[model samples]
Target chain A: MKKINYNRELCDFCGTCVSVCPQDAIELSENNLEITDKCTVCMNCVYICPLRALEVKNEG
Target chain B: MKDRYDVIVVGGGPSGSMAAMFAARAGVSVLMLEKDREIGLPVRCAEGVGDKGLRSVVDINPNWIAQKITTVKLISPAGMEVVIGTDEVGYILNRKMFDPGLAELAAQAGSEIITKAYVNGLLLDNNKVTGVRVRTLGREFQVKASIVIGADGVESRVGRWAGIKTWEKLNDMETCAQVTAQNINVQQDAIHLYFSNTRAPKGYLWVFPKGNGLANVGIGISGEASRHKSPFAYLFEFLQTNFPQAAIITTVAGGVPCAREPEKIVANGLMLVGDAARQVNPVSGGGIVTGMIAGKIAGQVAGQAIIDGKTDEKRLAEYARLWQKAEGKKHKVFYKLKEFVYNMSDKDLDDTAKIALQIPQDKRTILQLFKTALVQKPALILEAIKVLT
Candidate 1:
């Protein structure tokens, strides 16, 4: 179960994830976006995202 | 062991208090926490609320109001003023007093509220939100709740703690600074908006009256434009040249996100309301009414979910559905419209304003004004007509 997942290649670096995530799990660190905490995998960010930058991936 | 709460309301702003009040009204065990020693300290809003929009949720209290406005005077960059008249424009509230009054209303509605308490994060059990860990006065404690309502404002931490995306892009945010001042020359009852790309690119300056030659004058510039100078710097220059005699009484500087909506507003047993959810208007940057509206919907749905004994993501998503259905469609349209509007050049804006002033005042519908501003074809105008009419 990949607890934290995002495609940096796809992210527009919009910071939409920073404002909407409830856990404060996602933040732009060192100008590179990183998902800090293991997200609930709710897909709220992936779904509501206008750019479709993030998604849930199985943590193998 | 402390008492269990049916709903834990965090951040004792208007939205939080409203959530606590509505939840407690349903006979639920509600607890509201305010980090500040006193609620509504360091006020951060223009305090304007439309009469009709506000009446949809709570009744108006005469004592809470500061000034009753009937007209809005909009000024273009070249100083062309357009007056919009309405029977019930809005009231510029005394928010320092009004915010606490809302919390008092929640208390009166049987909700227990504590001041000087900060919520650290959510207590998760089996990946479901169960409670919150709070730190108050150097002491840490945990409180369990069946449901958690995050009424935190623009810089909401609770939303992030629960795993909801609370990030706002720079383009979607307006850096604003306002001041309450005296000796203002603007009309007493008319709210004024000064639009100039040079003054506030991607945003506008506002002069809202506070009665008796006093007013709250402010300006918001989008972050992209603000790279050259801060909103405070731009506003001070404007005031020095325009209203140099005015004496400042108080100042408020903050960020207002212009999101069509937040990245997400719901997750499992948690929900974000008010500015936390990015429900502020895309154009005017007003959030009080929309926040309260979304708060009522979120609180009502959260309370029902608690009574039903289920607080999962699917169950709580009703809050999101309710809010989206409330104004989501308009927001989508506004987002698209904002992109188009902001892309206009300074000369384009001045020219558009000149053309708009040519429209007969009585025929100045929103559609007509928009058409004048943008050289849209009849098809686009018709599309807008269908949606608006």
Candidate 2:
């Protein structure tokens, strides 16, 4: 399945993903960020991230 | 974590600390939670604040200020410069210390503070915010409180959970990128702002000096404008074109809400402050002072309401009413001004710059510039009268 994946090394935790999340799936505190189950793989976060920290990849 | 408290403040920024400080000072038990390992690590803001407005809320600490500025320069799209000598002073803060200083005041006021405490969810009782479900170091706790203050920054889950509609529309959201750079070739006495739709649509590029050969250079573009090309692209171009030799030390990107219409800041047993409430100035996209102001008012109201044993929506409306009168009403006028000024074409801006140049340097104020340049609209003149005076 094609699933959304997050790369912690690149994430800035600036909450740009939270700002654009249609499902409110992204929860971002100051130092940490989590993508909740409410995510529908809409790809808004992937496209808007300035660092390209989030991506879509095949997962088993 | 305790079983219950009078007020629980989420986040430990200016707004959160201000709220916690005033609430605790009013003879209530307050808890201020910060998710980060330290209170002021990983600075996110442009670190700009007005001296006069900042003093109204907290004491001035010279140790926290990087630079104190008195003059500003505005660059037109056509490269015309309008140098403005402001009556009020501005400060570029070192938020690594400034934020924690505010939290220190909150602690001194008797608010219990906990860092490395992440609030995952809200604890609700009958659809009203009763507490927070926070996680700390692989352990979870249901910390209860009579009122929860959401100073949780731009994308606030606390405000959203309280049914406060804290989302920002595209027009009001600013996607920003900033870098602390060294060896920038510019005067350090004045803040420089450049405006152009092609460069920064519906926003401006800024260079705030930090005194010792370092500067904070940044750009903000509307969320809608950034959809095609990210702010990173614009900043990269800006650095290449302006200060190609400057070395970058730190870079950050974030979303700042500059909403023309603020959300309902108060709900049953819960209050929102700072960026969470969209209390930011619409024109400048500055929120620190306004957030501090909102936090003070919310804390006082939350304290009084809790002391009276009533923490319902009806009782909490005082915060909304007071905030509207305090800063929200003026923000409405500012948003109108932003719409008027930024919507002007490059030709119009160039024309305004020409007009502004005719005035003596000592006589040029922001109000005078608006009065002369905004001669195109009669309705706007009426608004100008209400605002400038």
Chain B only, TM-score of each candidate: 0.94, 0.95
Model 1 Cα lDDT, one tens digit per residue, B62-172: 877888888877777777787653456699988888888888988998889988786767898886778898877678899998888888676577776766666665677
Over 4 Å off, model 2 = A1-5, A30-32, A40-48, A54-60, B376-389
lDDT of each: 0.76, 0.85
> What DockQ results do all the predictions give, each relative to the true complex?
0.09, 0.48
DockQ for candidate 2: 0.48
Q: Estimate the TM-score of every prediction.
A: 0.83, 0.93
Question: Pick by DockQ: which candidate is best?
Answer: 2
